[model samples]
Target: MPSDIHHPAAAFNRTSFEACVVPYLDAAYNLARWLARDDTDAQDVVQESMLRAFRYFHSFHGDDARVWLLAIVRNTFYSLRSKAAADAKHETFDDEAHTLIDEAPSPEARALISVDIQALQAALENLPHPLREVIVLRELEECSYKEIANITGQKIGTVMSRLARARERLKAELSSSSTEARRHDVR
Candidate 1:
């Protein structure tokens, strides 16, 4: 019986790719979804990023695959947006990202939350992509200023400024929506 041993270099290449890059797929997809704002577009971005990542994987220097793949995701989104002549300054969210908060929580967070708070989540989801991404990464992902800057390819000051503006806009939107509901109730 002859046992066939694959070449050492190809085996090593396969091992490294599976270990370093394959595990980051979910994280890549999530970040891409946020950036692209559409599930279909997100998938496309992920595929493109994966191909690019694999092509350049040999140059990777660190173990933080999340950040590396996320950079690819960000780059892919910008490439498509620019090619389509999208407004560089404007941020848009696709409908798939829309969702109301879990109103009837199975946990204790809801103990302190009222209908207004639930409405606030829905309002925040309606915010523009740039604003929403900052909120999601900062608040939900609990990323630091430096990490946010790296992921979005912005200066640290820009990340702080954008977060402040996004929070202000979200507050106003939630307040107005809640106020309109109250007005309707009174009517």
Candidate 2:
């Protein structure tokens, strides 16, 4: 019986890649979904990112797989966005129609869910891409400043500044929303 040593390299590659990258799948998909703003687009972006990561896995020498994977995801998203931009024609955005509204869930449904995830999602979505990306990386992904800086290819100072601005914007938006809701309730 001849032992198959030829398949060892393939097994090693698959195992190592899985160990390094599998844990960050959710984070990658979340970041992709946020950036792409559509489940289908996000899935596509994540798939592309994974393919690119596997192809260039040899270049990955870092300790933090999440940051590295996120960096790839971010780069892939921007590349897709850039390509879309190049192909884009005139398209007018209707702000009024697209504005996020806080709709009250029915009494039965409200009893089961307490937190309003949609409002936060909408607030984050309304932020500019850079600001939103920083917030998402820091808050949602729970990445450290240095990790975010590395992933974003920005200085730590820039990441901190963007995070600060993102927080302020989110606060203001949420506060204003609450105030409007209160006014509506009093009417």
Candidate 3:
């Protein structure tokens, strides 16, 4: 049999897809991780999302690949979440007893950042999903309101409102945590 030769158009499409999608993998993973709240699940979501993105890449004509890819990532996460929810009904898992162990930080790293980082992370994680997503997209991902609206399929007004609410809640949580820490210090 003769060696199979690549079609020029197929080669171009593959190159274009890689160029557009590869650079934004980190951003996609970050968004998925924040939404899923688990590293393994986030990785799974990203992998599935990449497949979806590739399958539908021909339809993508937008200028911002990051926003487009993030939209796919967010949708993939929700789809997985829905399936997990359905599965959860038939299972009996005690989340409180299921703990995840994080890698230990160096002593100096812990001393410099651990307390504050942990508090902030906890606060972010405690926010409602809508609020947490807006925070991650706007602040951490540095996405503009228009970008967020496109990714979330929300109106611009809704995106702005959610972001404002998320910021206020974060401020309140951080302030309360700081006060509690100060009290412990005084004690």
Q: lDDT value for candidate 2?
A: 0.80
What is the RMSD of candidate 2? 6.0
Candidate 3: where are CA atoms >4 Å away? 1-5, 86-112, 184-187
Question: Which has the greatest lDDT?
Answer: 3
Which window of 10 residues has the lowest lDDT sum in candidate 3?
Answer: 89-98
lDDT of 1 by residue, 24-63 (tens): 7887787777666567787988999998887787788865
Candidate 1 residue-pair clash tally: 0
List per-prediction Cα lDDT, in the order shown: 0.73, 0.80, 0.82
Ranking of models by TM-score? 3, 2, 1
By lDDT: ranked, best first: 3, 2, 1
Index of the highest-TM-score prediction: 3
Worst 10 residues of 2 by lDDT: 89-98
